[model samples]
Target: MHILVTNDDGPPSNQSSPYVHSFVRSLQAAGHTVSVVLPHIQRSWIGKAHIIGKTLIPSYFRPGTLHKDDGVASHHPFEDGKEEWVLIDGTPASCVQIGLWHLFQDRGPVDVVVSGPNYGRNTTALFSLSSGTIGGALEAAVCGKKAIALSYAFESREHDPEIIAAASQVSQKLIEKLTQDWPEDVHLYSINVPLRNNVAEAKILYTNVLQNRWTTGSSFEEAEVEEEVDPAEQEKEIREGERNGTNGADESSVARRKQKRFKWAPKFTDVHESVRAAGPGNDGWAVKEGIVSVTPLKANFCHVPNIKGEIKLSSKTSISGDQILASSSMPKLYAIIDYPDPYVQPLILSAIRSELKDLDVELISSVQQLPSPASPLLQYRDYESVDFEHALDQPRSSLLCAYVVRKALIRKHYLSNTISTWLVKHPQSPLKTHFKAAVNFELDYAEFLDEALVDAWDLNDSMTRNEARGNDNGNKEWWILKPGMGDGGNGIRLFSSMEQLQSIFEEWERDEENSGGEQEEEKEEKEKVHSPSSGNKVPTSASYGGTMTSQLRHFIAQPYIDPPLLLPSRENRKFHVRVYCLAVGALKVYVYKEMLALFAAKAYQLPSHLEVDLSCHLTNTCLQDGPSREGSVARYWDLEDTAHGPDWKEKVFEQICEATAAVFEAAAREQMVHFQTLPNAFEVFGIDFLVDSFLRAWLLEINAYPDFKQTGQQLQDPLIGGLFRQVMKVAVRPFFDKEAEDNDSQGSSEMRLVRDIDMGRR
Candidate 1:
């Protein structure tokens, strides 16, 4: 395969991204054609940002002629022409974009786009989304090319070229093996490795992205002492004459930039995986064990709706209620759909690169960027973003991206958003009407299962005649209100009466209206100064009630759970569980074996003071983990610790599995009609569940994207590092498994029963 490698960490002239040359050599050693491009300076933390309408001047390093210009010089290849390894000064994403459209336009379709070997890891959702290493790969996927994002983890911040050089061959081998039978709907693989001299050979671990984050932001401080700065003489310098190219960076400036004596303030705090959410199989855990973590990620976000499930009634029966779609050995045209969501990202992609045995197929995307031959004869398989029209011209015939499902405007919130609560105790799903909730019961917190009483209302809704009558019981009733699209307990309020709820909504809506269309004043923001006085604020230690909240999208109302369970280990603070589930093609569901337990930021209490203490009712980590909140330090514990010993623990896990399976089954039954599976498609959901005082788990919120601003753990790489490996095996690897030629027979009968909805044939 011909590979083009690039990075946001730039040009050889600056000696940045010290591993680029070795990486290119390794690609050549593996018998693959390689091309390279780099920015002029380091561009870290710039996620998918592009320099549009601006020309970038990239100065190339002249091999064999070392001048006192920029940096290193080495003999690689294609140096006779100015066109090789086009070093354009641009963003990482822009490099990939330009390489595909302009640089490689005459070289034919690029077989692969490899980005990074970045200075640090891009594992957690927070870091990965912000990393140029990942940004490049995501851009390639966006443009319909096979892409790989690579990162190396190390204790030392200094770049280690020898270690990177040594790992190059290993990386090629592993990447080659992983891409052998890549899937259709899946498109990207994120790999992270730790460099250790003592370790000889390393095994790769499949894992999920750790949902973790940093606790503090950077601050400037006065220098306490003068420190020595490294001279730029350590790096080799080369001069080149290219149009719009820079001659070299100033030696004094470079020296100053590398200084170690600068004083920085407000030391950063240690990372805290959202309390109660860490598991042994995630990326953080894998890195600690010293292994290469490969996460299969996708760029699609859609909720599949429609499933006509065949129900089989039974108590504790391990039987399925749906008829399996029979497999047939038939020729099929392949189509792919890719939809990228800004905040919600896939940890890895499972798209394979080749055809299965006796399978005549061509993989393609709907986007019109790549060069296509005139009247092609191969079976054209097109992969495209959600908005484009496929070449097949058959609506719904194309396979959607691995993480996306059949989505409709109204169904978006109803399935995975706040209203997801309706599914748990859905009136039409099943049960003795015990599934009752406001607009949706499925999304209700486990602790609030039976606590749901009031129906959901809107801004236009008013008091009914019966409500106007105001019975004695009505006055005593209380309510919990939240947004259908919200997280971290941002907008939450506790209400004592309908009148109060209305008043609060009015105020909140007014605030929203005033702030909705406003843009950030970047110049003004940068000009503001922070001082000790500004940091100080009046202190308080009480929870209050009455109309108060935010997250004002679609509001959900429920009766407050009376006397909810509180963790004894956490000063009687309320908490809940955040669980994950895999719904393969919307046919079946598989729940993770572990869960996170996020504790409330503050002690449990009723609204008493003037503040509506969101930390008390909402257990989202971000809402309560900050220093601004008054709590006994935010914490999370594994659910294993919460189980009632071995035997009872088994029961608890089994119940969770069954409940989760039942919920997805209903979703499938209601959503199958709208599903158009084409051999390759799947979805993984991060569904949060909460357990009440009665020890019952209620499905609370369904998060479409896995957010790591809080739960991402401190490990070698990010969390998806290990989790995505499992996803590949379970979700996208079988389509090309000639050995498992008869595997389709085991689709619905498999132990996990992740519904494999092959569009036409398997």
Candidate 2:
């Protein structure tokens, strides 16, 4: 596997730098192709700002590769022909872009992007905006790539060989585990190691970002001065100076004279005073108490509602967007396939039809045979005239269906009527309803497709340009592209750019337009080519042509939120609330049950300018010091441990539950309007939210599908089983009994009509 290594800390030098060469060599020793890209100058503290105009200029420097030096024990063994050096003039983020777009252009896709082995620990507040490390990892995540940012924490400036060795060992172990069993859809991981000689004894704790603060207080005062005179020297000096009338010996000498002494008094002011008052249970407190912290992060910042309600048939019904099913009455399932992944339409349709056994489920294809094993219950039906497969294969009607099928699905679900005939007889129906509907599923899909189109074009252009320039670090264009309809981060791509994607979209559009009355069978070939069955390679970069644009219609751009900086005056540090919800006893009961919260903090010196901002920044355990190069100083404050004494913890917990309940309410209402269904079943959503200094809560993204895997081996008796059982009870049960009854009656009527026709013939 090819490995791409990048960092925010410029390039490495011949002189000893623990991070650069050491990290590269380790990966190389593991038999991976390692490429390094870093800033030309330190771009530390500059969060996600891309070059707007003339700011971004390309500069080429020497490459830093493995070198054989006699002094360092970590040096590579002298190999006669191997050259080990590289240099690039770009920010750490730029390095990742270059490696993906240019350096490995011919080599196919890179396996992973690793940032750091940073000099200091990047935990809690520091993790969010630590450009020196986290920035690189974030760039990869945004581009839809699997990435990891690694750092080691030490007690002091002194380098401990044992700690270094231990960190290296852990890195290797983690890489092995992650490479073999990394979860799908997860793009990045932030890992921190404690600087202890006993790596085994040092606990590897998985924790959330702690909201804490460091103190910044100081003062200045005037010094006291005293003057004294020496008798013999003063008399002689005064006699000599008196001839010149320069205030010589005698009276002047006695007054001004002999010796002068000054006393300079310096006082130490506690800049961390405010932070100290924050009490405990923050990331800073944990780190101060000596514990390693690891926090999992997400790229998408949207909420995933447990349930949505919509007015349907004069009754209020709860629904979920994921539960929305497409009508099976349509003969042909229109699908877009760019890569090899065969469209899994058949499987999805099968799943839905299995759940709705009474409904008419038809499988139409231009191809004579079905792609998968035929379902006995879903009767594979044939249509006349139109060869949907052939039409799908043709470029004439491709793009149109990309729009048309989506339009059809939306109309069917919203109006509860099939729009195929309406679209033909009234060709302007789609136009009339275009963008009028508040909730459009196809629109979201289109948004993502458009972004992918742009990214694909940009990637191709950037690669071509980089190849021409022969600059190894100029390829920041390759990206991982994900489809909007895709879930669990599936249907991803390690694509080059927009040029390759335009043809695909154009073909899809053309097909839909030309195949106006074509039969489903004729269009099977075309549909098969673009189906999800064909394995799609994940794209490397999120941006196209270096422009920041959302690939998916409903997608969002994510920024790195630095973990809060924690001061060392407390016990445990870092804590986060994980609220869970369920529909119990038919009343839609949501609960904030379990919390995997912990205390942790980063060790960092605050700049002078950010002091006030730091205090007000609502120091959670997640954010570290902000930019304070001028007079401003970013301070860190802890949350007062009102929880332990006098019911503070319980009170805080109750408030968290209330806030989560509010979020659920908002989400449920929005979902209701969108899905037009009743909230009947139970769903367990892990909502992660952060609280500020004033105890004000800000919501992070909601995880619709939270992972059950534990970070450590600290599971107790019930552990995940209890949560799983609760979720399974709701997920397995059929939520829409009314719809099912309606379908059954309709089926019975059809059967009776057939029987009556037979009897009349007799």
| Candidate with best TM-score | 1
lDDT string, candidate 1, 399-508, tens digits: 33333344311132354432244354564532112121544322222223234324445311323432554643333444566555545444456665545555554554
Q: Least lDDT summed over 10 consecutive residues: which range in candidate 2?
A: 753-762
- In candidate 1, position 665 carries an lDDT of 52
**Model 1 stretches astray by more than 4 angstroms:** 1-384, 387-398, 402-436, 439-477, 486-490, 512-553, 607-610, 622-637, 640-649, 670-680, 708-711, 714-722, 738-751, 754-762
- Reference-based lDDT, residue 351, model 2: 34
Model 1 lDDT-worst window of ten: 316-325
Provide the global lDDT of candidate 1 against the true structure.
0.48
What TM-score do all the candidates reach, one by one?
0.45, 0.30
User: Which portions of model 2 show Cα errors greater than 4 Å?
Assistant: 13-17, 54-85, 213-291, 300-762
Error of 1 at 472 (Å): 14
lDDT by residue (1-762, candidate 2, tens digit) is 456777655555322235556666555433344556556555544544455453444443433433322321112322221223333455667677777786555434777788876655565553345345777878887887878777665544445555665566556445544554566655576666666766534544445544433222111212224544444454334323322223332221222443544222111112123224444433333444455444455654111122112111101110111222234552222222111111121222223323433332232333344343222111112223233344334322221111111111222223212222333444553222211111112222233555433443434455466456442332333332333332322222232334433433343344444544436434433333222222221122211211112233322211112232232343323334444444221123344344544232322222121111122221222222222111111111223444234544455455655544443332333333432212222234455444433443334334433433321112211233333333322222222223333333222211110100111100
Candidate that scores best on lDDT: 1
Global lDDT for candidate 2? 0.38
